[model samples]
Target chain A: MVNEQGYNVALVGATGAVGHKMLETLERKKFPIKQLTLLSSSRSAGKKINFKGEEYTVQEATPESFEGIQIALFSAGGSVSKSLAHEAVARGAVVIDNTSAFRMDENVPLVVPEVNEEDIAKHNGIIANPNCSTIQMVAALKPIQAKFGMSRVIVSTYQAVSGAGNLAIDELKDQSQAFLNGEDMEANLLPVSGDKKHYPIAFNALPQIDVFQENGYTYEEMKMINETKKIMHAPGLPVAATCVRLPFFTSHAESVYVEVADENVTVKDIQSALVNADGIILEDDPSTQTYPTPLSASGKSEVFVGRVRKDLDNAKGFHLWVVSDNLLKGAAWNSVQIAESLIKNNWL
Target chain B: MVNEQGYNVALVGATGAVGHKMLETLERKKFPIKQLTLLSSSRSAGKKINFKGEEYTVQEATPESFEGIQIALFSAGGSVSKSLAHEAVARGAVVIDNTSAFRMDENVPLVVPEVNEEDIAKHNGIIANPNCSTIQMVAALKPIQAKFGMSRVIVSTYQAVSGAGNLAIDELKDQSQAFLNGEDMEANLLPVSGDKKHYPIAFNALPQIDVFQENGYTYEEMKMINETKKIMHAPGLPVAATCVRLPFFTSHAESVYVEVADENVTVKDIQSALVNADGIILEDDPSTQTYPTPLSASGKSEVFVGRVRKDLDNAKGFHLWVVSDNLLKGAAWNSVQIAESLIKNNWL
Candidate 1:
């Protein structure tokens, strides 16, 4: 199917929430693609998708589906990526997986293009994207880390329901309407679909994101803690996270506290570092009541930073409010940027 | 109207949210009241409030409103408290003010009955109820600090829209309905009612809580920091807070990180401390997806503690999720409890 004008690219999980954004991002960024194949699970197969005024049919993915594919983006689920990512890689395709499958495999490079693009070059045919919560925190922290060394990080997140998937989005919509109507709000999926219990996410906050790990931290919380150290290349960094799912449908907002290694770093110093960073927008001005909210950052690609202030007691400690569209910069756009980086740097 | 059986009580801001809750709590707790005087601003003066099967008319509060008032509970705006609290005290009334007007005044005691009922005895006529967000956090941290001695505290709050007042609750409800109807969300009051800019709180998170202070922190955040030190009697304690307003209408949830001074402390130790502490509930069972959420804790009087986990790197540090009904424990119930202590201990 290759016309030799550009590289052959295949998108796995084309029916997913992140997948929908990935396709849109690839088209908007004008990614080099000569032949585009859409793959999904058997349940979602035979679907039609319109891209750039062209209609494409989705097919159930098999190992043979990746033949001659130069680039593959996987985001269906962990099991799907676990079973099919190697198949795609074995077929001469570089995989940028958005699941937690091979992120800590030691052979894979976990990357946030803005934070750790150089690690993409060392991928063994498959690169891993960090969690949505981790991606935004690291994107905002990288600039500060580059200018002033960071000693510790503690973050608490207000995440969106879209990160749970499309069905979860539907659940929020239904529940919000029910709650507004003074009716009983029914919940089928939230907090986690596979978890033992489901809680309502409309006009409420759920403290759990993923399944609880053995060490008392949720898998989502551990992913944020471990992924930040991996992407920043500081294996000994002390990071703590408490991930809570709010009722929002788009962006994830985080309250981050960082202790810098350098002495006498003021709030101005932190603002100067983030304002000039590659993919960050600083919107902090308390006098004008200016700051980024989930609604304001719903569709933006760049990470938004605001509410910067110094810890009243600790001279080196600073607090920041970081917000970004979880589907865009957190997953889809970050994955597409990795594909672009591979082609730009001749890493593939 | 004073009788020999019970103390005469005066309720300020009788038509407001906290004032409504105050009436409900006083009735539920069956506080001894021979006569009740309802007072409010001029706009709400004629509003009729039903209390204990009797209808009471709210009167415009003046300097003479507290004449023979044994206990005057003020929940109106800070300006009303600043102008009338001292006048109420001058008339031989014990004022329990639920505003920031006298909280930082050295002569007044900021009281959370669960943590520091003894501090109520030190009040110079006016006892200040700590901020709602602060009351819940300190109630959770007090037991832990008493058991292991805390050194530093970092908190990120998921506060409800009702914390801003009744109009904010209406704004959230109206905007949420509009958002669900595919209409634009109108914003008239949120983050701070008197602040220059108003952001929509429907399915959104606003980082600013109270008006911003000269120190680049919100007045709400500063209240948390300074009041925590004062209530805990630890002047050198390092406390940092980021207060964010979410769309929830009732309860406030907090993700707290505390560094205990003890050499070694486990999650079990922390839970045991909270389970035995007064006015605290331990609802942490990760295996069953148990945790305290805003919706679940909306009407509860106790502080709900869950998701207790030790830090991965520091053995002395721990993280906890705390939730409580802002109107009850954070405002009305707490203020009423202080009044009860004043009567029970004969401190008035």
Candidate 2:
């Protein structure tokens, strides 16, 4: 239930992709707001963004932008978040950042409320939203982790273009047109927009999601590895990831292989736990050909898992197919959910 | 490495996709053949197929087609293989069938030369080439299993349209053209051409492949499950699979999660072993964005694996991203390789 004492909320990076979705999510959830501030870089600052038929001009996010803000949602680039998120937090606003800037920080509570809602209370005016791919996986695996105590997880992701940014969505449209016309696929946006030497993703698959780290794992892969442990509160848990950028537009799908600690854990038990798991939709019926696909999960906030099965000989081994809209559960809805959790737990 | 006195050879279903590829393979490998017979169904009978500048007319495959045929390669539908394979075997002709009819017959040997070439001598007139996804995987994993002793395997596959045969390929082309013109997706072939509903795969992923089995795993999934056991000669090994059909024209990619018996194994050890393994090409240099992709692996016979890594805390577990040409390693070359193994070992 929303209170009459509404707070002033600001959306940083208001004109961007995830920011636009955040605007929609706030309205759809009927989030209480005494005032709304839309902030972006100077180039996009003056543009007017419409939310619930109410037009708000985007203002440059400076140190003073959050003076009267009680809550702030940041989906701007990591550089922008690093620059101004502290200002917003210091001005007495609870900041939920949707970038990699603060996700791995020891003090910041990296959250997917369905998995780590209580951790929200420990945040010192800032909460880190996990990576799009990591968020969906943890949300789906959390229930199973609670029931069976996950020992190890191996995931290969089929991520969408939107996770990269608005430029990537435009690149997908442009490259797709070139591919259909039998022209050369021009790629300047992904697997990393800032990284050198890009490859065509229109009719191809890229095994790299982010720039490679020194240890051989892409930053995106490390995010999944590190964030899985953070969100599930299992620091020593075994997690490995191979993140690939597919030609898909929005939703992300993962092929997850896990080994539970319990020797008696059957696939049925995992399915039952997932069916009752919060914020997760179990689509495990195989007879009618029911399973999760990225297209089906597009724009939805729920994590969809299917194709859950046990290994022929190992009673503790299992596999799952998990999918969720990266724009939703991966970003906007998750940020908004954390905001709600903060308010409910009296931490806002 | 070369032999001159090879047995007489015949190709059943010589007008089909795999059959044409088989013909190309046989010519490329220059298999020693005293006589060559091309046999097809009644509909394709009298149709001539070209191989390396030679033309051979396809005759109706009947019980009598086996006369004096020392070894026959059958890629006909399961019904045709079931109906005529026994007849051919009774005529003193050994057969290598590429249909699901005899894969699980308990008497048939499902062979991927890199994995189970020794099982060829035990074949009761027939050896089976596994499903496209399973063949490549077993080829990559066999060496690892031999060195490490695997206890569990969980795989999620990204399969191609060509696995469904030529008609589906035509349908994909037609629908892609239609979708580009802003016309309806007009699905008729994918997910399952035999199923009532169809979905567009041009910019999408379909989570179902083959018809659904009673247990909910698609026939394709079951094929991987059963064929992995047969090829790896590990019927009691734990294996689970989720088969998905992507829009690619060739090659199949799998995210394989495996648990080895040795708990202290590292990702380095796995990579070194795979580099030295037969039929496996290690393409896992993440620094330069080097990994096997379907587009890169298309038309290639080797099982290409990349994104190999050990689970964070589980010393016994590892993940591999395996890719290969479904047409080559999965079917044509494997079939031809079996024939070559036969002559080399004097098993024919």
Model 1: CAPRI class: high
Docking class of 2: acceptable
Off by over 4 Å in 1: A1-4, B1-4
List, residue by residue over B148-208, the lDDT tens digit for candidate 2: 9998887878887888888877776676576567787767778987886677777678878
The lDDT leader among the candidates is 1
Error of 1 at A52 (Å): 0.8
| Candidate 2 deviant stretches above 4 angstroms | A1-5, A46-48, A54-56, A260-269, B1-8, B32-36, B45-48, B54-57, B178-183, B261-266
Candidate 1 C-alpha lDDT tens digits along B116-222: 89999898899999999999999999999998999999999999988888999899999999988899988988877777888899999999999999999999999
| Residue A163's lDDT in candidate 1 | 98
Chain A TM-score across all models, in listed order? 0.98, 0.98
* Candidate 1 clashing pairs, residues 3+ apart or interchain: none
DockQ of 1: 0.90
lDDT of 1 by residue, A83-172 (tens): 999999999999999999999889999999888899998989999998999999999999999999999999999999999999999999
TM-score of chain A of 1: 0.98
